[model samples]
Target chain A: MPEYASILFSEVLKILMLLVPVLVSVAMIVWLDRRVWAFVQKRRGPNVVGPFGLLQSLADALKYIFKEIIIPASSNKVIFILAPIITMTLALISWAVIPFSEDFVLADINVGILYLFAVSSLGVYGIIMGGWASNSKYPFLGAIRSAAQMVSYEVSIGIIIINVLLCVGSLNLSDIVKAQENVWYIIPLFPMFVIFFISALAETNRPPFDLPEAEAELVAGYQTEYSGMMYAMFWLGEYANILLMCALGSILFLGGWLSPINIFPFNVIPSPIWLILKILLLFILFALVKAIVPRYRYDQLMRLGWKVFLPLSLTWVVLTAGYLMYFDLLPGN
Target chain B: MIAHAVVFYIFSFIAIVSAIMVTTSRNTVHSVFFLILDFISISCLFIMIGAEFLGMIMLIVYVGAVAVLFLFVVMMLNVAQQKNEWFVASDSSSHIPIGLLVSLVIFSELLIVVGGWKYKAELQDSININLNLNLTNTQSLGNVIYTDYVHLFQLSGMVLLVAMIGAIVLTFRKRSGLKTQSYLRQISRERNEGVELIDVETKKGVKIDA
Candidate 1:
């Protein structure tokens, strides 16, 4: 193969390796989220599809394929169609920098964390576009709500990540995970971790911060106008985003692929499995919250993000930096 | 080198077209969306040139934040409804000439900067943007911003703080008749205050008022 063709072939293969599992796991995660929620609510989940309801997502995917796509007459035709595609694409692309294990990643850029942050921030555009294109009162309101909610929480998330970055002294995702070999950032940065987890929940618009799609109020929120595959795209994008946040949380706090104890038998398991388990742990929590918590009023959600998390995270950043400086424990670049 | 030029031109093309659309779009929302596209493409150009930190910051601050605010305001104000009238006749028509003059001044200033750079490409090293080839983009930026330009950076932060405070002061108001939730009061209230038992005689109900 020519140099460029070889590069292209390898890159395409890597993308497939990463994305195929991601798309498949999205299906699995949907099933897992439903099962967890059902367990929390004391109800049997979708056991009718396949053994242990494993093929439920496949059935759902087929249903979406067969269903009719309805475009509103007054809707912005181009953007309405583009919205879900953009959402799903952006969600998948953010995985490019997410270090699954030590050297296993699509693109191991130096500023990987920032790239993730940047991509996640752009996630709001899909919702905004979908809502705006729908040309309906409820969708517009939902989009506006989503924009404010995301923007407000992002500040705190950025600050909280700074606390981790300070310790790691590098922006590379692999370096961040490596720094936690001795002890996870969660031990020292417990408060920031909790705040980060909550912010992650809000960032992904999971309940109780899921006011954008509160169902009772906005009638499916931004998804109101979407039908068939378009609606399924939004659902897939959302779950992927949720999974991304879980991966991020695990990477930042729980030690990305590190075993619980650095001993024999415990360390025998592969790193990727550890990452998957940590992600599953976070996903279960996400689903449980969905089942257990009541939806927040829009005002309370804003108050929590801005009034509470922002100041708390900002102060924690200062405090952590101060502590590091005082102890002369600042990692050399 | 050929691939680099190709990618550069591609991103630059997108940035320029989106920049034009931002100004020419009839719908205010479309203008905002184009502005976001412009930001993204410009940031892509930045990243392609290895200024990854700057590129990501641009995306986060502008595409993610500023454009969203623009979209929110445009959507809420229903600016598209009056787009034709704004083009034809507007109460703020007098300000248009002044706006054009200010824009011309800024544009000329940018032109001068670019022209100077074109003549003196090596003049960059004398200034603060001394890039160390060994260090990563984020590290180099941190080194410069925190070491040599630390005071200036701190001052800029202070300026931002003051501006934020000033904006809050401008918007903050005390409304006499406005009803607002006092979370502290709500939480601290005694059970007796919230619930009361009153004796009722015959068919008459207890007075809930007072």
Candidate 2:
């Protein structure tokens, strides 16, 4: 009983260790995204709160917390409140299988990547529920858009990951990272990497494909009715999900926790730091894409996802399988 | 063992309640939400029973994809406001007695199956496959799926392909009047073809070709 108790305690501690840093990073990411947007536009952004507005996210959080949560009178009150909680929970839970380093993952399950995929695929629920519960037209439209968009992009992402899994031969994320010790999958599967990154952008509802929440048209999309902390929860969940996707990209393509070059200075830094650096670099790319790329038209976005990316990723999967089989490089073979 | 039973009971309880709610809910959207809850609870049950892969896939397929599609259709059709009347409507009143009788019969049949299985140990011999405890659920599933069940898997794939093609073919419409961008024309246009410089009087715009 004592041993079980200790196990439970340690598990809680580990979850806290993962959750706190993730929550903090989510806040910082919001700040970072704004700053990046500002830099792209040649303007100083959020410079007043702290040094270079370091505490801007904190201030925002405080403001959100103090504000009144205005629930729409016509809305399904229970579902409206439950939607953000689901989103935030799902966003955070996918990190369970993400290996920070060799031994640091919360759950080193067999189907790690599948677990991540499942959690991410479920993210559409929050949007759908929120939109529906709002009892509004724009939110409903936004929800429908998000549903179709996520489903379409997920097909491509699934195929792309299957290509990686073909090379790695294991669903365990740590195994994937370990396999990249000699050569990152991105080196050989460059096109797949790019496709995965773009799909990740769409899956996370990032810019260029963020038609679900296209503010100009949909008035913040499914988030139209949300306000105060409820709205902030959605925001935090979005950034957290973005960070999760960045981590996933780093893990799958950039060699999670692995040094770029095995030279003296590069190898000196610890593994988690390497993971963090890769994630930050990817996050920067995400922000840059948001800044540079114009938002895709709805039809154009659908075309890119289904017509272009789907076939491309599917072909890559076949090519990858053939190559692995021909060269006798298939893992477990 | 006690903890396992406790968790199992909790999940099963939630699953049963949510399953009931899925059918009984007045709002269509609420019904879909309850259906999602039902899937999630059942998946949790699967995971607890050591079928983690199946549980995760259940989550990915049903709760994630299928339920979202249901919600999409519900929201898109604007049917969330429609209150479901199971037996209250006059025209559907006859369905109430029949439904209750059928449900009762089905429930008894299930109960009989369970009770009979408990007493007849030899009946289990009808089952051909046994769970391989040594391998992970995914590994075992892969082994069977790629080997003995490969044909069945491919058949299912073909079914899905046909369904997809059918959906596309049914919904696809080619409207003639809409002006669509031709990428090839846009990209292939040269400076000479796209531009024409002519000396013209400032007041009289060169007769633009209609």
- For model 1, residues A149-198, the per-residue Cα lDDT tens digits are 99999999999999999899999999999999999999999999999999
- As a whole number from 0 to 100, the lDDT of residue A325 in candidate 2 is 86
Question: Going through the candidates in order, what is the number of backbone clashes in each?
Answer: 0, 0
- Model 1 reproduces a share of the real contacts of 0.88
- Where model 1 places Cα greater than 4 Å from the true spot, the runs are B89-100, B118-122, B125-131
A1-333, model 2: which lDDT tens digit per residue?
A: 998899899999999999999999899888898899899999898889999899999999999999999999999999999999989999999999999888988999998999999999999989888988998989988988998999999999999899999998889999999999999988999999899899999999999999989999999889999999999999899999999999999999999999998999999999999999999999999999999999999888888998899999888888988988898888874
Instruction: Tell me which residue pairs clash in candidate 1.
Output: none
Cα lDDT, model 1, residue B141 = 80
Interface Cα RMSD for all candidates? 0.6, 1.0
Candidate no. 2 TM-score? 0.93
Chain A TM-scores in order: 0.99, 0.98
DockQ of each: 0.86, 0.77
lDDT of each: 0.92, 0.90
State in Å the error of residue A97, model 2: 1.3
